[model samples]
Target: MKKLIIFCFAITLFSCNSSAQKTEQKTFEVSKTDAEWKAQLSEMAYYVLREAGTERPFTSPLNKNYKKGVYVCEACDTPLFKSEHKFDSGSGWPSFDREIKGNVAFGSDNKLGYSRDEEHCATCGGHLGHVFNDGPRDTTGKRHCINGVALKFIPKE
Candidate 1:
């Protein structure tokens, strides 16, 4: 009985250690400054990407863009969306069925006197856009309405 109890305690300790290691492994570090971001991105891109401002819809070339590529954050260069996830929502903005894992953080948006979930970059906290429930259920059942100026698409090879 003592041997069995010791074995159980060892297993628990191993499990806890593994779990702690996994948590540590999942943590990511963000290292960038305003000067670096400004130097790397245009003024408009910096406004939308660093200041969390929304760009005017129907004005982004990405809305009508059909290129196959990964859309990365304009400020941080973090991969945010894939071309396969993009779709025409006709909402005068670029829409995506889903986002790259851990790329966006969702929050309650009370802006415009309405309640909606806003999607922002997880890395830089830049407002990429908002999310809607009205989308193709066959996919992720989500409409990630994004600002085209906030993203830079790298065409697939």
Candidate 2:
């Protein structure tokens, strides 16, 4: 009957709007409001870190960086990865063989119509990027494909 059809439609709408399938992020030690974060981060950094946006490939200067240093979260300055793990995955973005364990957290991202492991700064819960198993077989074999704008490089002394 008409009532049955309406109920079904309402259920579908609610299901689609629900985020039950997505992994939940924990409370970060460093949290900020939208306006506060926007004020500190550059336009692109804010987009990628705060808004969960990705930057254009091969456009980040950090992508070509080969210096010795550590990569920190642009949002909260939490160290995420080291230059030692940096590798050329040819994925356009800055790829890493592994993350500095305990500094980054993983979650499920089904945004692109498929499931991908999403990475974020553990301290601030800012969106970093995704992780894959297609990295160097010699290393940890994890391709932490990160948005360059999400990181700020600190050179080794």
Candidate 3:
């Protein structure tokens, strides 16, 4: 009975550990050292992109931008979303219905204790934000909630 109890305890311990599973290391096209990233990005941008942090809601000026432009990764200038796909998600962050295909990457984020689909730049692996199912029914139902600091808007010329 004691041996069975020990085995069960060990199983439960490992099951609850988040680090028990090994994550694959991804290589990005625009790789930079920590010092280089810090020197290149603003404080908030570095926080959101490199540290996987979130900017305060409604604080991003890009949240209300309605101009026609392409949103590119601030770190590597890789186009990630088009202005046409942008919409007012009312979630205080820049929301997009779709991505610029093959320029963005998706991964599972479980930092909030629950799993969420996270989006990042494929070129630099910068943390943009989480994607949700709540979006316009007429378009793609995926709401790509992104941090404005992680992006640089390039107005159509």
Candidate 4:
């Protein structure tokens, strides 16, 4: 009788653990084709916006950009990062102190076999860029190192 009780409890615990693991593995899917993406964005925009390509540093208009507006995804026009969160990290790329709530997702980027946090658009699952821990103290202690070409700044009127 004692052995049977222990076996039942172990099975229940294992089932619960398996379900929890499955729930935690949820991820967004980005299965759009290049043609589909290009129909929504310009040539340059499509290259950097949906293809996860980086633009030349110091060449982005947003680098020295200081406007009171929202920055959105250039491809899908989804609101991702806010202008208030934008800051100069001196890395040449546009840096953000934070992203719009639930607008971006994170994943382990072992592309070069080096571990780094890669950021993606939560809505379309498009690769926006990587994030770092070094950032201003006024906002969240995170540096959302985004590609400038991936965004479109909507200046506040």
Candidate 5:
């Protein structure tokens, strides 16, 4: 009886520590060294794009931007979200209902003690932000709460 309990406990322990859920390392089209990234991006941009850090809400000037243009990845210039897809989610972050297909990637994020759908730039694997379900129902019901520091707006000509 004691041996059975010990065996079960060992199995549970090992199962919890299993690497089955470990995310695979992905290769991007654009890769650079840490130093190169730091040199190319601003301090805040580097934090949000490279380190997955979040900026203070309402701090990004892009949050209220309404001009017609495309928002691109600050690190790789990959077109991410279009201005038309952006909306005032009131989440303080620049919220988008959709992304330019294949330009953005999704991954699991459990940083906040809960699982979230994390978004990233497919071109350079730069962390953008997380996507939630609470969005405008008329369109794609996804609120891509992105860190504005991770994006660079290019006005339409």
Candidate 6:
């Protein structure tokens, strides 16, 4: 009787734990099919925005850009980050200290076997990049490491 009770408890515990891992609730203002995304986005943009692929370091022109502008989502043209918050983190990506409020969404990414906070366009559900703590300590103390291909820089003029 004691052995059966322990076995039942173990089964229940395992079931609960596995169910938690499967919950990934995703919702966005705009959604599209694969073909629609491919038709609208450039090849490189599609890979990073739709498939969450990373661009090579120092490869994006935006990494060296210092123009005053708004960085928008290539997929849905949603305003994401402002140039005033942009910073150079030496990470070979377009780094920002903050994003426009309510335009971005975050999720837990465990693809690398560890949890990472992945950013996405709140409107289109497009993958943007990840955020980190290693940023200018003087400011908001956040490093929004975003991909260049995933964005279109619209100058403030």
Segments of candidate 2 deviating more than 4 angstroms:
1-25
How well is each residue in 5-109 modelled by candidate 4, as lDDT tens digits? Answer: 999999998888775466353444555677888887777677766666677788888888998999887766779988888899999989999899888888877
Candidate 3 lDDT at 124 equals: 94
lDDT of 3: 0.95
Q: How accurate is candidate 2 locally (lDDT)?
A: 0.92
Candidate achieving the largest lDDT: 5
For model 4, the stretches where C-alpha displacement exceeds 4 angstroms are: 1-31
lDDT of 3 by residue, 3-118 (tens): 99999999998888767577778989899999999999999999999999999999999999999989999999999999999999999999999999999999999998999999
Indicate the TM-score of model 4: 0.75
Native-vs-model 6 lDDT? 0.92
Of models 2 and 6, which has the larger TM-score? Answer: 6
Ranking by TM-score: 5, 6, 3, 2, 4, 1
RMSD, every candidate, angstroms:
9.6, 3.2, 2.8, 6.4, 2.2, 2.5
Q: Best TM-score goes to which candidate?
A: 5
lDDT tens digits, residues 1-157, model 1?
A: 9999999999998888775456332232564678987898788888877776787879999999998999998767789999999999999989999999998877777768989998878887777889999987999899999999988889999
Alpha-carbon local distance difference test for all models: 0.85, 0.92, 0.95, 0.81, 0.95, 0.92
lDDT of 6 by residue, 1-157 (tens): 9999999999998888896579776767788889999999999999999999898888899888899989999999999999989999999999999999999998878899999999999999899999999889999999999999999989997
- Write down the TM-score for model 1: 0.74
Q: Kindly state the number of residue pairs that clash in model 4.
A: 0
Please give each candidate's TM-score: 0.74, 0.85, 0.88, 0.75, 0.89, 0.88
